[model samples]
Target: MIRLFDSAHGQVRELTLRDPGQVSMYVCGPTVYDLPHLGHGRFTLVWDVARRWFTFQGLLVHYVSNITDIDDNIITRASREGTSEELVAKTYEKSWWDAMDALGVAYPDDVPHATQYVAQMVELITQLLEGDVGYKTSDGIYFDVSRVPDYGLLAGQPLDSLRAGARVETNDEKRSPLDFVLWKNAKPGEPSWPAPFGEGRPGWHTECVVMSLELLGEGFDLHCGGFDLRFPHHENERAQAVAAGVRFAQHWDHNGWVMVGDEKMSKSLGNFTSLTDLLDKNDARAYRLLVLRSHYRSPIEVTPATIGDAERALARLDGLARRFGLVALAGHHLEVKDDFSWSGAALELYEHVAAALNEDLDTPKALAQLFEALSSANALADGGHEEEARELAVALNALFGALGLSLVSASAVVDEISQALVNERDGARTAQNWTEADRLRGELVDLGWTVEDSPSGTLIRRP
Candidate 1:
């Protein structure tokens, strides 16, 4: 049986997927109001590892991460940015996609935007109302946690204890302090859709249940997110789904928050590091590698020095991979051995990682295994499998792929850049603009792709 950490229980729980041996997973996605950050990347890598280990164990994987387009934050950002709500959502969505691409994270099978599912959200909310689990507010609609009876089941906070967090003063129209909005009455100049709720928009919790039921179905394998989401967010979602007469998902997985310098990383706290800025200087694939070095469920405190160490470790991995001399005859499988304590320890740690991940996503322990694996791989490269390390490279890639940390080919796009420059220079030469051609050639050298002009043609290689 596959096991994953259930945030609801705060314990590793065994899981049984559909079709007797397959896992259908749905992970809660980002808010999309701002740029994706290192914290977001860490949570994504956690789920990535979950999907990968399942596949490694020969289980079919179907993954979906939702995009929340409509929200209070999105509205504020759209107004501030002087763009339409749709435009704002699209801008950040595209930026997030680009960031994920750079980080070597695999694209999900489906990424349905919440705005695109207004009808589904409306229908679900209506059904919850019919089930007596929700009530229509003066402004729009809300999920009455008092009706659910077990509203705080997932969070373990109970109804009374959570009153302070529900921000009841803000929503005086709600029937109870714990109730959450299902839909909001759209105001003038706001983005609205013609729904049963009289031209209002969907609520925050409505999207997940609707999208999950539609894509992964009521009884999907995993429902994963960050630990902070376990409260009103996931709890409300569970109530919404149950009230809609839909089957609830099996597992609830949530990663802990990332703190910086022993404080929660937050915008108000001024400790958050964004993905675009961080990745511009540090390599994304390498950063992903560093993230995978730790487990998903554990709290991470990202710092410049930590990221630098990751870059150094990634450089070592890349250097070792290049040393193997991957030949064009990449047709057969090979075995590898290691001698260094760290490298040996790292490989041996995989067993613990597998066991921990399968036990319920104990990410800290699993990450320990990854560090051990890296150590073992490093020592193996130096001692035992230095020459015959092809399999080691492949295994590292396969493992890293689960974490979405696979090293990108340095030659992949640098070739296209070279070709473009060459064409520019060759055109300049033909046009008798020899000065521009020389400048272009010099630019290529500055970018680390040495361009040598020869009798036959120009040759390009890393300087």
Candidate 2:
């Protein structure tokens, strides 16, 4: 039931798995040069939600997100810090993993580093050279864009008309302005692998092409990354596939960047906030809720006020769970009366929120529905329909679990108190103190537990 825009097709498309339940997905990960920012987190949250919802919908999702361990950025960082490239990659790779985990984002099923796939990339480039889709230059190997008839189809541009606002080097060897590098011969002190052509490393675009083809056989259910990648990065990836006569990604989904105070957050800007900094100020759950407020395709603006609001909302959800847990702990699901159905409402709320999540991961709408369900549950609990309220609360908690969100433990203490109340009631009945029995009933009521007197005894439920 998930529908996302395939930027390659310029249309929102339904995701259909070739096998009834097999959902294969790939997302382009970041180059490990610096810490993660809000801008870097947008597409990650998008795919993470997609994985959660796909599993919720009974699909077995295979997610692979690539890590750009070897890149020009890494090289530059190493040089600036007077450190080895391997050391730089190692440090930032761990940083990246920790940041993603703290933000309530789950790791992909497989993370293949670009450095580990050098051999595959070399093989891919060799094939391209042999196929006449690439040519050698004194500097490196470059993809001959002139070979691919539909070179610019994915980017919605014309190769011959790539003359406006271009920033890349206008090399004399390139036949057209769009003929991007497949490999670059090592400059002095830059890391390089000696190849048949020369000592050089693969280009930024080439690693992804090789990685996707090697892992997903050149065709997959969906390819995902930030909208900024739609141009040269993803477009070049598609062109390589077409030149190799292979099917590329079935659908391409791009999540927009997070704007800083006013501009798009990037490492180049001092306005960017690091994930670690955000984590130091807020718990993982609060940070997650902040990100989930907006649809992934839309631009998200990160601010202190926004995150504070997220924390308040999460607190409300946690409180509701605590209230419901107290009631459900006291009785079995089957023995509950019509008025005491917290578990039922919880499940109902879960269904609605899950459906909202599936429809393109409309997180804000899903979160709104969750808050609405919580409100009703709270009202019901406050009104003395303890069991009815418990049902709704359970649903919200389970859905929160599915989204990988965790508030503090509220379920434990509630259960303990409920058991103690039952014990106290039993003690009063044994002593035959009618006066004490009525007093205990009043005490329980005051504490949000309703005790109803019957012909046999008093029936207790969450109020």
Name the best candidate (by TM-score): 2
CA lDDT of each prediction against the hidden true structure = 0.71, 0.75
- Candidate 2 on 371-403: residue-level lDDT in tens? 787799789878989777766666666566556
Give me the runs in candidate 1 sitting further than 4 Å from their true place. Answer: 164-167, 262-272, 326-353, 362-390, 407-463
Query: Using Cα atoms with residue i matched to residue i, what is each candidate's TM-score against the true structure?
Result: 0.78, 0.81
Residue 349 alpha-carbon offset, candidate 2, angstroms? 3.3
Q: Runs in model 2 with CA error above 4 Å?
A: 163-165, 263-272, 326-351, 410-463
Residue 273 miss distance in model 2 (angstroms): 1.6
lDDT of 1: 0.71
